[model samples]
Target: MPRFFCCLPLAVGVWLFSLLFFAWGTVLTVVGWYGVSSYERTDLALTRRQLVSLIITTSSWTLLPLITLFGMGAALARSPRALKAYSTALWFQFGFSVGAGAYFIYNLFRRNDGNFVTNCTSRDIADRDTCQQAFNVLRGVIVAVYVVIWLIEIWGGVIVTQYATERFQRSGGGVQFSNAPPPQGPGPVILDPVMMPPPEPPILGPAPPGRFAPNASGRFTPPGGQPQPSFVPTAGGVSLPPIIPIGQSAPQGQYAFAMPQNAHGPGAANQV
Candidate 1:
């Protein structure tokens, strides 16, 4: 019922691993039974070590099919509870694998001991060293096989766990992962030349004052004579703020102008 894309495939992978394990275990179980039968047919009775191996390996197949069925069914049905049960079964098998690996490694180390698995004390067994070497080699092979199975079990367990989780489900798409990335915001702002208003001309100096002059009269005029000034065009309109041109700078106390008419030093008031 999950929506993750990898759910179905990962479940199937787990199922396949279980199937492989069941088949391998069943084959080993059959081989163990055959070995026990072959030993029983011999005039020499089976050794205690051989008998123990036979008991464990022969009984392995009995429960493998049931466990495999559980895992495969859960995988196909996509049932979380069933998958969990299958994992629990695998945990027991994992325990067995660990025990078996330890036994084989120990057996390999003890191969040179006097009481080795193969009874070289018998008259027919002429080469005791050769027999021990062969037994050690067999134990090494079994250990290698167990190591491979351990890797497969780990991979299968992980796949099953992820498949059962909310992250992986049957619905299909390209790598359907959870939590989409946060929504992107608008890009940085940039000024456009066309949208900007044209720069106004800069102010050069204070505007010429407009004054009222006294009317022309022959009679003496009082000190409080009214004055008037004729209207004349001014050099600069100082009422408004100055605008600096692009790529140009001006001093704080001075305006940027090509020429100046203000007097300097002592002749500041003289027009000449």
Candidate 2:
């Protein structure tokens, strides 16, 4: 829930409100400078009372943004990196709010005979009394503008503080940031005989048409009844290929080689 408050919506709302007040204040200031409604009906006469009103009205425009800046600073205190910028904006906003508020209250207590003192008095007449009526109207408008500035600053400040609190709570009173995962290592390579060995040579043997003849040893023998080559044996008990005797050729369909087990010991060859 606290996390939710720190979201963009609330932050944007605060910014917008602050912006509105500043913008409105500027407009009011410009209009007051152009000679407001009260000064239009009067003969030309500029007085200190009207001058003060004018200065305050125009100053209020500058004051709004000042207050907004200060309020924004207070709002953004959570982010150390951005604190300086936020603080600057907040202070600016505060300055504007205070200036506008104070001037507005000052004008409230001062006025003239039926003419609320205003800032739009003309210099056509030398007497200060002539400008009293116009100054009053200007004062009223300036006061309203200041009131708006204060309200906006208050609203904006509340939003930022509340959001900051919620965000801190959600992060266990700390800041939470996400980081990317580390990369993975490459896979190991495996070698298999079937996948790596070269293609094998085709086995050569006789055609399948002949019937095999058997010798006295019950082994397949050549057509002439000759003794056939036998399989040899090796130390590991695996049979080695069979081999034909000298001067003899293997019959069809027969691979003439000795199995490993059939091979006699090394010196046994000399006995034979």
- Say which candidate scores most in TM-score: 1
Candidate 1 accuracy as TM-score: 0.49
- Compared with the true structure, all predictions reach lDDT values of 0.55, 0.52
Per lDDT, the best of the predicted structures is 1
Model 2's TM-score against the true structure: 0.37
Error of 1 at 140 (Å): 1.8
Enumerate residue pairs that collide in model 1.
4-169, 211-229, 212-227, 212-228, 213-227, 213-228, 214-227
RMSD to true structure for each model, in Å:
13.3, 16.2
Q: Model 1: per-residue lDDT, tens digit, 123-208? A: 45657677667566765786787678678767766666666553223333225666978789986555554555433233334322
- Tens digit per residue, CA lDDT, model 2, 126-217: 34554664555655775686667567666665655555555555557566566967778975544453443232222335424332344457
* TM-scores of all candidate predictions against the true structure: 0.49, 0.37
Worst 10 residues of 1 by lDDT: 230-239
Instruction: State how far residue 210 of model 1 sits from its true place (Å).
Output: 50
